[model samples]
Target: MKKLVKLIAILALVSLSQISVAGDPVEKKSEMKMDHAMGTMDESKMMEHLKIRQEEMLKMHDLSNKILAETDPNKKQALKDQQLELIKAEHIQMMSMHHPKMMKMDK
Candidate 1:
């Protein structure tokens, strides 16, 4: 009878510990609500970011092809320089989007 009581007590403690580990339901609900709100905003921003990235990638691809096709060394070097400038401009644009304050510091 004593062993049976001890076993039941241990089982109850284990079950109670599992419930505590589950965490606060109210906090979890609030977090879920916040996540849902932010997710919508982030989705739109993410799509816009992807569109900008696509444009930059297409421009870079075209420039790379032009650079490869050019036979004159001076013209090829000019194309390469142009490509470098494009990359720098893209970096600045991305930084401005994510860190507008940092962009001001760059100037």
Candidate 2:
């Protein structure tokens, strides 16, 4: 009888622990709500960001073609330099736009 009681207590404790590991339903619901809100708020900004990325990709493709067609080493180097500068500027702009808080913290 004592062994049976101990077994039942252990089983109850294991089940309770599993339930705690499953997480709180109320907290999950609130997190879902917050995610939904953020998704809606950022939908337009996300579209704009995607469009900017596509444009940058197109520019890169054009620059690559120009580099491939150029016969002069000096001119090719100049084009490569321009591409590098453009990429750097774009990176800064992207960081400022998407992570303004982090950029501010850097200062």
Candidate 3:
């Protein structure tokens, strides 16, 4: 009798788990539509971001060339350090902009 009860309990738990795992079809369809819309929006935004980044990189390249041409050792080192910091800051800003909600939660 105890063995039978244990088997029934296990079967009940398995069935319940399966029921919960099976999502509603309508909800799934709606979620897919929303995801598609979001994906399209993100693609456009990503392209714009890439264009801006390219422009920024070009400017940075020019600045870097200028720094490299500097003759003073101390001034060159300072400019190099400043450029490194600027690159780091831009990287962080881009990441945060791409994942705004996640970045906010992280803070």
TM of each candidate vs. truth: 0.52, 0.51, 0.46
The candidate with the higher TM-score, 1 or 3, is: 1
Q: Which lDDT tens digits does candidate 1 get at residues 11-86?
A: 5333322111112233422222224444544565556545544554556667767876899999999988986666
- Against the hidden true structure, what lDDT does model 1 obtain? 0.52
Clashing pairs in 1: none
Model 1 scores a TM of 0.52
lDDT score for candidate 2 against the true structure? 0.52
List pairs with backbone clashes in candidate 2. Answer: none
Winner by TM-score between candidate 2 and candidate 1? 1
Q: lDDT score of model 3?
A: 0.50
Residues 24-69 of candidate 3 have per-residue lDDT tens digits of 2333222222244446544655565445445555545555666758
Residue 101 lDDT in candidate 2: 100
Alpha-carbon shift of residue 48 in model 2 (angstroms): 4.2
Off by over 4 Å in 2: 1-37, 40-48, 105-107
Q: What is the C-alpha RMSD of each candidate to the true structure, in Å?
A: 24.8, 23.5, 23.7
